[model samples]
Target: MTTHIPAAAKIVADLKARFFPTPTYRQLQLEFDLLLEQRRANLRQGRQQEVRGLLVVAPSGAGKTTLVARVLRQHPSGLRMLTEGEERADIVSMVVPSPATPKGVGLDMLEALGYPLRRDRSAHIIWQLVKTQFAQRQVLFLHLDEAQDFSRHNNHNDRHAVISTLKSLTQSPQWPVGLILSGTPELLDLVNMDAQLARRLKPVEHRPLKTSVDGGMITAALRQYAAAADITLDDALCKPRFVHRLVHAADYCFGILVEMICEAIGEVLLAGEDILSTKSFVTCFSRRSGCPEGLNPFVVEDFLALDVRRLLQPEPGPGNQGRPR
Candidate 1:
């Protein structure tokens, strides 16, 4: 028996596959290319040397993960392959586990390298296995997403150990591995904890979107996404005022802006409508934020006054104001 998927789900999936090459993405691509070039140069010179890694710091919903995934996917030697029943991976990617410790992260890395631990092991043993697995798999680049969890420890020594382990990965004499550490802004503090580590990582940050600067891009995205879904956007919805409100509704994040556009398109498509309008966006925003019509930027007259960043948070308790969930 075959199962049928809804038209809305298909459209949403297609929309999610689309990528916008923003300035940040271009910068990330250039940095990745440079890192790969350094690796090649080292190989040509027949020298074992440490290579610089990337430190990508951004706020929540800034598309850091998407950007890194795209870069890795496009690289020539990024994917794993099976040759003669042997697995070889040039890139190994994993998310840093919460409450990240050196041991926990080391175990996660080993697992990502297809060498899951059979039993509990010391941090030292786990990392030694990780380094061995990295070399065995021919993994050159290690991408750790949500890496800010490494700083969650209250003990200064524990945090220092995490930083040291990351530094050591890029400086391993036998097989130096390039690192791609992406996380929230706090990750910067983690890197800065050690001066040597800070110097080894090339930092790339994702800045918040500016309404005046990004308005045109956001407008184009709306039209492009609607056209992709075979829906025409209403003229009023593309006006500058609405575009600004749309940016605000997305909390000035590029990824969130794209998501909102896709959501609005899905709403229209699922409703058997051919035209995309403010009502579609209003419905999508309401569904995502659970905000009342009066507080919704897409539905209100004074949208600028709405604290969109707080829209998804529950109401504040007495004296505890404007806290996020």
Candidate 2:
């Protein structure tokens, strides 16, 4: 016996490969290009440059990591440095550890650079290794995501120490690595404290869409994605009520908005439906958010001013064991 697959399912699979590069993605790409050019010039000239860092700042789900990672792919590493005559990385990327400290950050970088640390050592020793390995590998660019985590557990003095470590990497006379730091807005605190650090790093900010500012863009994108999936765009989905509700449900996050749309589309495909409907979205929202039908924005009437925070709260359920407050 042969199993049948729905046409909508095939379309959904095709849609998975689609990437709609928004204005923010383009802007970030342009910034990365300029920075790469400067780094190239420095490598060719054999000198450290004044502007050696770039920071991409955005909220939790503004797609900072996705955008930066995509840009990083465009600049593949593992090239030989002309002066050093060794295998060198054009760009190396890693995430800042949660509850970050100077030492943890060093280990993260060392690991990303493929260094082994079998023995226990001090932060100073690890960091020394990091700088030495960076020079040896001829790494010209370093990209750190979730950079705000660096400030999570740091006090004033500790924060300054972390900042100093970052500054020194770019200040190296030999093999100065251009830094790309991407994180939430709080990452700005790392630079604001030091005037020189602030001056050396350029900032690229990404923000979410608001009903007033990005309503048209959001609507157009939704329609485009629907058409690509060979599904009819639900009229309710195009209305202001549903659009803003989606924005709110996604915490005003662009990445999450995309996710919500994709998940809803997937649900329609699974249901073997030809038209995307508010009911499909309602089911998706309830399943993901754990909100009841009355509170589900997709289903509820007079949901204009509904606060979505309740959906984000953890409630006891089949998979979760109750804990005393």
Best by TM-score: 1
TM-score of each: 0.89, 0.83
lDDT of 1 by residue, 81-156 (tens): 3233466777778888876888877877676666789547898889888888777776778889998888865379
- Give me candidate 2's TM-score against the actual structure: 0.83
Worst 10 residues of 2 by lDDT: 77-86
- Badly placed stretches (over 4 Å) of model 2 are 1-17, 75-86, 300-304, 309-325
Q: How accurate locally is residue 292 in candidate 1, as Cα lDDT from 0 to 100?
A: 68
lDDT of each prediction vs. the true structure? 0.82, 0.75
- Residues 136-162, candidate 2, lDDT per residue (tens digit)? 877777888898887767989889988
Residue 176 lDDT (model 1): 89
lDDT of 1 at 153: 59
